[model samples]
Target: MLQSDVPIRVHANWRPLDPGVLGSAGPATYSRNFAGAPLTNTWYPIALANRIAGSDLAPNSVDINCNFSSVFNNWYFGTDGNPPVNQYDLMSVVLHELGHGLGFTGTMTVNNNGVGSWGGGTAFPVAYDRFGVNGSGQQLVSTSLFPNPSIALGQQLTSGTLFFNGTAARIANGGASPRIYAPSPFDPGSSFAHLDEATFPKGNPNSLMTPQIGTNEAIHSPGAIGMGVLQDLGWTFTTAMMADDSDGEKVGCCGTGKSAMMQDLKMPDAEQARLVDAAVELTKASVDQDDPKFYEQLSQSLMQLKQARSESIPVEPVNDAEESRRVFQPMRLRTTTPETERISVADDPVWRDNFIKWLSLPRRDRLRIWGGAPVLAGEFEHCVAVGGGGRFCCTGTLVAPRVVITAAHCFHLGCIGSRGEVYFGLNSNNPGTGRVVACKCVPHPDYKLSTDEHDIAVLILDQPVTDVAPCPIATPSQIDDAFFLRLAGFGLTETGRSGRKMQVEVVVASNNCSSSSHQSTFGCKRDREIVAGGNGLDSCNGDSGGPAYVDVGGRFLLAGATSRAAANSQRGCGDGGIYVRIDKELEWIESVVAAEGLSIACDSEDESEEQSNSGSVKKE
Candidate 1:
């Protein structure tokens, strides 16, 4: 339940006890940042990277595990608990564990045999491991000085004097490197991974992450140095988030809390058991019915029921020529034929450029959003063209053989004639080649035309597309760990108009309205959209409704769908734009597909494809 540049999803569960652990959480997977760019390779927590791509990319970014057994049950759920003495604050522990999962622990590990290695056996170090140094400021991971997997690195791990070299963290620690908890004994889980406990004693502002929790203590926020390290990790906070550490001396996030009473009291095991039992009883005590906040948070579960209008099925009505005038006989057959013809005049970039200017990028810098590399032949076949007679108004992704996901804005009569044509393959010149006519369009119930919130729609296709394997809709976890967004579409190119599909990688700007780059300048609300792009790369004219993908391992997952130029983009393409975070629309998508007589159950064969030619696409 945290967000930085984008929406972040972390699900928590009460699980059986793991010995000597109260709670634990970390990224489910990790990956190399990118290829053919920049510095030495760096690994990123896959779930954190997905946050930059789209929301709800998978079920959750970090799977949280907390002990809930009777043996580990002496806990206070919130600050208002009675007789809170001897009780551990669950919120404080949760915050501390979340801090680590978000990005704290590293790959460095020390073996008992006087040897140490980083990367957890990977080829590159994680982003956090890059800033570590020894007592004399020697880089721990560098082969030039401290060769990896050597006695030198091991000595540094147990040196009792390691420092974080990040400039931001140093500044936060009073212009000096923060002392790390590298004890002589070298505990694998604690050594070299935390702030020295003595330096920031219990209740110190930066003690929340000191590797230990104390009874009767609660940290209100991540202390100053914690924010600094996260800043060094490339996370930017809003003004309010930054304001948490302004006072400095508070016993909050990243700081120590109340001293360990049990550690000092030396009570007998029987006495400790009695105290634990009392704490458990406290949890079961009745709540104060008059507590307004309690009642507010305890709102009853709700279920909304509505009757939908019966729409026309697969057959397009020839009831009126104007309404069905654009209907083609392809709807009458289950198969299509390819031809050696150019794209239709309506969709031809060259033809459209003669008058209309934008597609995803606005026409005036208004419509489809870019100048990017042309896709390889037969690549991204599931990213189809949406419109008729080979003339397309927007782009879409095939989620199922008979289901296509597109922007709600593209569901109008003028845009795609309500029931429009869908074309597959790189060239849509011949409507016969893999063209699947759409029979119905279903827009989100809460879709807002004025704000573009929930700017998504579903199109039920007339026939199944067997050749092109559909993309798997991303889950919340996948979205949070995405490092980049692959914008792919049959859009306008720099040469004015090429029917070939184009794509470019856009950096995620913000995932929510509050942090949107254009929030102040344009009052742009990315509430329904995810902001991404910049540096001369973007989805542009004719790229509307395109698929924005995230590569999970080697498989490309559908993270979002191109909607329009970002609310803040004055130039449309390069300045960055917005895309519909398709992940958040999973429920509506499943419902629509089900209503249309399509079976797209998440874990079913509909989401699976052969791995030989097309990249793998899975729901998980």
Candidate 2:
């Protein structure tokens, strides 16, 4: 609780963001050219503004998309140092995001050409910007030293050396100014808003506000410099010598693996929020909620959405998914598309460098609908989210202690080496909150990107995983045209959310082209592929490289791997999905395990005997 005459009211919500952005906050309301003050349009994050104004100013104060942590990757909720590596502290990230909402940002920014500017390029510095200065004590905002926005000012922004000139903060910093982040080429989201990471490295009391966080890192308090900066920004303490940092994440940095640069987009405040939301809304089937209150809200939103024509809303097409050369890249032209079909961006591969492009679309009214339901906690343990090389996109399943099976297309042309980390978890609600295991991946020799033929890969883990049992592989004889498959993935759904594990059952719509019922000329018969399309049940983004299972008795056997949306489908997901017939590739799968000098997963004599003696194959 804050000791204010009124109170600080903050409004925040959970929504999917780009891979790295954790959360974002800032002024919901800005005062332009104030009559009395030092700076014009000095922006204040909503939290601070609320404390002074004594009322909530906007619909929501902060927009947090730590959705990656809840159900996705390995983010440590504990402040203790037990998980020594790859753990991104959840509380630390929240505090950092909250810190921005509470005014830990500056107005300084540099363009691609290294020209610096402040006050949103209009001489209107943020409230925090008033105290900024260079290492030599020259105020960056002072007209006497530099123009409002100039190459000279830009040089100072990326000089790798800048500081906050706040008196209290300087005093807290041992009489020297508090350093700020000013890298060249200016990381637009991180440059001026955060403290310099090096000068106040992750163990310092002032590191909570830094621009990048490494894995396994956590900060429990906001540090001394944070309070000092707040003090300099007009916040008063009842009795202050140094001030209390009961404002948590106290020090510089906590723990982590690699330095990851993350920033939440300023919400409701940026002009781009709606556009981003529109982009997100176009990709799903519908919204869902298990909680009563949220469900009720969603029910209302659904009705309102049903009455409105979605085509009325203009969406700026963003080619975020232009890459990855999606296997189902063949799009059904609109002229022939049924009017009932909703737009789907599921086939788009645009998940990278997209945080800033996201606009604040309504969190509740989004056009998300999932044909699948959330799986119970303990089920589908073998399913995983696969990411590496700075891209957090596909999904995979554990087939053995050290082997993961996913789509060959998930990786680049040649699986020359280990691709990236394999995440072991059911959902990803925060930025990084899943148990991670490193692995080396090799795609099938016959895999073809052009026709998506033989789309399969065997990812061999660097070490064995003992906690989760691998999914048993089905023998070639067990699969046929009469197939009912279980689809599981940590991918996007109708709720405008991804990274959560969802399960759906779909029937084999078509297998061989010769018997008629062949879905499309785009090749249902192309390269031993199996087709499964449901009206609203199928896999989408983040589910690539995932497994499709078939039941034999009470056990589910791995029968296929998620390849892409059906080439003939109207929407990306929910209409249908293509799967690589894994039963046909059993020989190749074992060959990879044996060649890698690792014992094959789930092919042991005991398991085979247990299965052979078990009941006959059953369909769902």
- Whose TM-score is greatest here? 2
- Provide C-alpha RMSD values for all models, in order: 22.4, 20.5
lDDT of each: 0.54, 0.55
**TM-scores vs. true structure, each candidate:** 0.39, 0.41
Give the poorly placed runs of model 1, Cα more than 4 Å off: 1-5, 16-20, 35-40, 51-70, 80-83, 240-620
Clashes of each: 57, 61
lDDT of 1 by residue, 1-620 (tens): 24444445555544322123345444433433333112334554444444433433333223222222223457787755232777777777677767665566566667778887776534566666777888778777787787778888888888888887766677688878788778776664455667777787668989877766666777757787877776665455664233234446221122111000000101223544554455444433467644433222221000000001000000100111222223211100011112332111122222222211112222121112243245557778888877764466577888888888887777642456567778777655334445556556777777655545666888888777777777876655566565457778866543233345666655565343543333333223444456565434567756677798876765777888876664444443455557766656776777777676564423222223322112223322
Q: Return the top candidate by lDDT.
A: 2
For candidate 1, the TM-score is 0.39
Clashes of 2: 61
TM-score of decoy 2: 0.41
How many steric overlaps does candidate 1 have? 57
lDDT of 1: 0.54
